[model samples]
Target chain A: MQLPFSLQPLFDFLGQFTDGPANALIIVIALIKIALIVGGLLQIIPFIILFERKIISWVQDRPGPNRAGPWGLLHGILDGVKLFFKEEITPKGVDKPLYLLAPGLTVAPAFLALCLVPVGPIIQGAHLDALVSFLRLDPSIIGPGGIISEIPLAITNPNIGILYVLAVTSIGVYGITLAGWSSNNKWSLLGGIRASAQMVSYEITLSLSIIGVVLLAGSLNLYNIIDSQAGGFWHWNVMAQPVAFLLFIIAMFAETNRLPFDLAEAEPELTGGFHTEYSSMRFALFFLGEYINMVIVSAMCVTLFLGGYHGLFPLPWEAIATWITNISPSFAGFYPWVIMASYLIGPMVIVPAKVGFFIFLFIFARATLPRLRYDQLMDLGWKRLLPIGLINLVITSGIIAIDLMVTGNGQVELATKWIIGAITLGLFLAWDLLYYSPRRKAQLEKDYRLYPKSAKKGEKPALAS
Target chain B: MLVDFLKGSALALKHMGNFIIGKGNVTLEYPEVKREQPAFFRGRHRLQRYRDGLERCVGCSLCAAVCPSEAIYLEAAENTDENQVSAGERYAEIYQIHLLRCIFCGFCEEACPENAIVMGASYELAMNKRTDFIAEKDDMLDPAEKGFGDYHEYDPYISHVTPESDKSAKGDPWAVKAEH
Candidate 1:
């Protein structure tokens, strides 16, 4: 086994201090990486909350939060301060330890799951080129350079990245369950039970949906998955496995307890559900956890389906680097930053922008769709999405098998993708139409009856208020 | 059925897209942009004056008689040589409208024989004290001079509705003749 790429430099620097093992240096580097990722996430969550509000308001045609500061950007900050100072209240009878532990449990998994998701590309080769060409640093001074080549804008890359995310997210249910159960309130208990059941049911569909992507990428590591989709928009999993994309999006919404599938915290029914007994910072943690989870899920969707860090157009990095170098003698040193930015920071911006679109969709869907009844939610997860997901997995695996057996050429693979994508789209459209036909007809007739234009003179329309 | 669902979603998407692109917002920023009140809007009452600066009220007590809320109070006095207040023999020595009891029904405006008590557009009648609700003669009376600092821009919609009314109120005989 080799030392991870990011820890090699640390080990090299610490080598002179003592003739000691590199394990301590590696651990420190790991700790620092973890701190950076967590700090960035904590800073980002409030803005995401603010963005959700702003998008929701814009969709509904109102200027939202422009009063707090420029475009109401500081409203979230003000809100966080307000939540912090609010009186912390624990109701008459509650299980003390579990109630306290629940919010932390909910928050921890979300933060941990973000570790494996790469936000930017590894820029080792280019950085090496830049170092050799621009900086004129001694090659030997940057020790073990070839060994520590992978430079990713993420905390760490585990071999089982996808599995880790699924496993960690599953554990998040316990937090909700404990929060509801420990509250000693019937509503909270009901919310907990609903959340646990819903999450469990959706987890199957969620895992099964990703089976298609995994099969296509042939890797569980998120960085590898994104690397596999680096060519163009067409190479994204969304095109290759359209069925899986649809299933993942639906299941992701259910997993996160977003609206339409948000049975657990259905404000009308559960009165804030599991977190009803929480107050101040505890309540704030749960809220923060929810938004961070949203960011993580959005990032995952971008990584999996939209081709994470892949530019929409093929990036001409060498040209951009040359342009920067020609700008002036002073900018020669900055060419490396420019080159790294084109490949690394460019995607850093693109990935977030794509994730933001999904976030907007989440908010838009909340505004557009009504909540599903409890039975409908269960039936959709168990009966509809599960079967559909299983069928999609089988189809995807079948395609992969065929590709391996027949002419294993790139052209054949492209043709296969197009064929499978078309078939899946047709099937989905047919299923959706058949499922919603009766309701559509009923809705139309209901509308006609309510506002009948052919009402006789002196006769009133139904017009029930 | 699938087509229907798609259609519904498309319609919603179109509406939202229009709004995002800066369309369909009819919301007025209330504090900044006030709405144009209608000509018939009976807000706080005001006593009118001729352009030549003569009070229109004859102190006939018609508005006091017709006020359903009993919000009006007046005291009649003989017009003196040095302080001739009205265009008639008698003038209101003390006229007050207790806005607290006033129903804003415009009956008082309709009952004024001299067309003196017309409701102006100043609807911000809030007061810190109970006594402040009572508008004395000074508060109700129109400005003595035209283009007074206290005057507001009149609504074009109201002016369009009653073009002759403004001219006659301003004592513009030429405009009244042109209208006739």
Candidate 2:
């Protein structure tokens, strides 16, 4: 039976866009989505500042900057103004050039990481056909591939999309390292060293935990992963990969340098850390840069594992999308709806929901959790999350093997997601029940020191001969 | 074993009182319930205006000169016979106290020969702007009549509280304004 022209037009347009009303609308929505997500981030960063102040104050049981704007928002702005005019103190014996360059280095990566984050529902709207006839191009000379595919709003949507996130985020450490080194102070050196060590140790676990998500998704392209989970509810990674989710969220807090992890400028004691010697606006840059890093991590967490901007859950996407197309012209014309729901709904609804959730989670954690002693932080990274990553992978591989053995294929295996979740919950309880006890932690440290080196237990401790 | 557990329970209850009922040192709900401030309390400072609306400060550089912490910085312009603003020969055209540097010693108050400047009780001096702390005479002055009675209106300068109530009942005459 010949499928009629109206249906044919919709599918044909979608399969290969002719820069029609639909395609143009999709492009415009993508650009608007980009602007909205980025703009929301710029506006949200200040409130995160307020959120941080309020939460910290509450934790300490004191009022924070309450005088500025309603809740000290004006104070944050006032602080910025003060920074601009206040003496830009340059420390003695500091490297004048790199000292200046370092703060921006930490900040720029934050915006870059936000670029791929999906934040709004993809509303079908006016999109310009970016493809155009160029005066210089001879169609004959221009190879088929030489012509650009319609340039998507994303800088690039490569198969290795999230690999870019991992690579770029690690680059943020350089800024802190340089700031610490360039300042030429002992405290800065100590701070830079700790930041480097913490970030480097955790990056491995952070990247590894997300691999569990990547494994579950079975692809690296962020848009494709998001696209695969379009419509109603349950298909998002949170339920499926609970352990990986926990690991990722924890590592994210550490990565962003939110409190407990905010030892970088653990003031009064740190006396401003690496920027202690910094005066005026030069120091203010470092301060804003820290907040920017927090924004980047918060945004990434929203996009990754949380379905970017998917609604609470997606129903069996293929079934729903297929049924709608069959049932009504309601779904007939809008190919972009599937993409737009994620683009529009996820970001407008889900991303903000997730970002708010995580920021609160961050505040709650700071209020509840005392900082890990420096060594303990390093241990959690190298000894704990790293091993857990390997164990998770082994179990995942074993599940894949079982699914292959039982079904004779590795595709779409139903592994024991419940068991994995239980195990993850058990480990978290163990961490809280065991490692979370400060008295126990202190005792353990004392005992650890008391126990002599195993290799040299029998020998007298060797003097520095 | 029962006794040990009971002892632990007793200890826990004691701690529970401390944790739940309150910390032993409960902070007062401030503003509504302020503690009686210390004997030598410094809450807010006011610059005095005379009965004829003249200032008492003579533009003698002594306050700035004598300030050991260099917290006080002053500049003077002579008040000639044609335009006399102060009872003294001079009035301070520019007087600044760098509170950031101030040790809060009453040295500048003591250095005034005319018994002009006195540190008052304004601890509400938090500043988001450094320029705010520069505090021109207008920001600092008492704006009160020279008569003994004007001292304690909620503010002699800008009293939301009656300046009379605002005044400490008694202290050094220079520091405290007396009601006529």
Top-scoring candidate (TM-score): 1
Candidate that scores best on lDDT:
1
Q: What DockQ does predicted model 1 obtain?
A: 0.31
Report the Cα lDDT for residue A300, model 1: 85
Query: Lowest-scoring 10 consecutive residues by lDDT in candidate 1 chain A?
Result: A135-144
DockQ of each: 0.31, 0.06
Q: For model 1, how does the per-residue alpha-carbon lDDT over A1-465 read when each residue is reduced to its tens digit?
A: 122334435555676664642444445556876787678678876787788787667666776667788878898888899999999998878999998899999999988887877877765665654543343423443323633444566778887989999999888889999999999999999999999999999999989888887877779999888877877787777888788788888888988889888888888999999998899999998888777777788888888888987878677777877887888987786665676677655445787788888888788778667798898899889888899888878877887788867876423265676666777777888887776688777775665455765678888766633
Residue-wise lDDT of candidate 2 within A344-439, one digit each (tens)? 454456667777877777776666555666777877788877887777666765665565567874443333444555566566566556654768
- Give TM-score values for chain A, per-prediction: 0.85, 0.73
Range of the 10 consecutive residues with the lowest summed lDDT in candidate 2 chain A: A126-135
In model 1, what lDDT does residue A188 have?
Answer: 95
On the 0 to 100 scale, the lDDT of residue A34 in model 2 is 66
| Model 2 alpha-carbon miss at residue B94, Å | 22
| Residue-wise C-alpha lDDT for candidate 2, range B75-175, written one tens digit per residue | 77888989987776678888777777777787766666655666665566789988777767777766655423232222223221223554443333233
Model 2 Cα RMSD, 1 decimal: 11.3
